[model samples]
Target: MRTVREANRWAAVTGALLLVALASSGCVALLVGGAAAAGAGTVAYVRGELQSTLDAPFDRAWTATVRALGDLGMPVTAQEKDGLSGRITARAAGDRKVTVQLRKVSGTATEVRIRVGTWGDEGASRQILEQIQHRL
Candidate 1:
């Protein structure tokens, strides 16, 4: 009977040691995760120059502008080209209507042709197009 009791105590001690090892490994993994997140944050803040306007084609430039606008909380549903210029129409997240044009000119961008209104502005549209003109 005494031998059986001794064996049971040994088993309990083994289980306790395994738990401690697992807990230690968990703490080390958390430390590694924190370090990786900090590294990514540092890399994203690096400054860089935009490509020269002459280096980009009109189709690519217009596509990039539309994508940029989408990233800024606007979603483009339709885009069309007529001659060298093109038009882009997007609805903000709240379904606000916004329209902007792109002139294939290099060096600098030009003004916005129109702004129908903000989302559900009761038939009123604001001129946010001028500010985001570069963003297509």
Candidate 2:
């Protein structure tokens, strides 16, 4: 039989390998970053957008997003909200188009996706997400 120490070592190695695999696959990013609070969820910068799921209601998330834009000096160009989803379009520095979309996942969870410009701005997107998380 394997000793307790040997079993623990094996488990650690397995966990490390799993993490490495996930990281290389771009899945680990989804499980990392952000604060330890309830709504301090992880964020991922994929394609041309930054995405995150906050443990807050849709209304709250929407409000925080708007506030975040204001805090970042982004001017709102258009906005719409409904029972299940919301979208806010803004203009950032250099007149870059910034879009934030929110979808209701549950009563206490909402998914937020942000895109800056036609392509993407990872730094600006991250700042917006951080601001939203702060407000949440």
Candidate 3:
């Protein structure tokens, strides 16, 4: 029974109210999605890669990353490191390429990102991350 303009106004008000309610309740993640809502240590699929933050110093995490590559029988083809970040590129089974990146988050925290194959093989990436975590 309401006119189009009136109905549109009502809809806008309803949306604004919903946003305010979600913000106040700290449930705004319903709008953000994925790891933003899941908290740290949660493996997230992002940009065709799997990522997770780790609780370890950069130096230690870097070492574990190298060890993990060996433990998984992946041959490290190349590696590069700087004070703030590093990357390890390896060849996995079936000649699939894997790349692991370590970024310093704090003195004792690092963010790890792994991608397997060109587009990304989620299962392989997750397994590689788990192996690195285990080594850590």
Runs in model 1 deviating more than 4 A are 1-57, 106-136
Q: Write the per-residue lDDT of candidate 3 for residues 64-135, one digit (tens) a residue.
A: 999998999999999999999999999999999999999998887788999999999998898888888899
Q: Each candidate: what lDDT?
A: 0.51, 0.88, 0.87
lDDT (Cα, tens digit) per residue for candidate 2, span 24-129: 9977755654332225375778899998889899999999999999999998999999999999999999999999999998899898999999999999999999
User: Which pairs of residues collide in model 2?
Assistant: none
Clashing pairs in 1: 96-119, 116-125, 117-125
Q: Order of all candidates by lDDT, from best down to worst? A: 2, 3, 1
Badly placed stretches (over 4 Å) of model 2 are 1-40
Candidate 2 lDDT (Cα, 0 to 1): 0.88
In the range 1-136, model 1's lDDT, one tens digit per residue, is 9999999999999988877786787955556554643331111111221111222446665666677666666778788986467888887655766665655554333222334444223222222322233444
Per-prediction TM-score to the true structure, in the order listed = 0.38, 0.71, 0.75
What's the distance in Å from true for residue 36, model 2? 15
| Per-residue lDDT of 106 in model 3 | 85
* lDDT of model number 1: 0.51
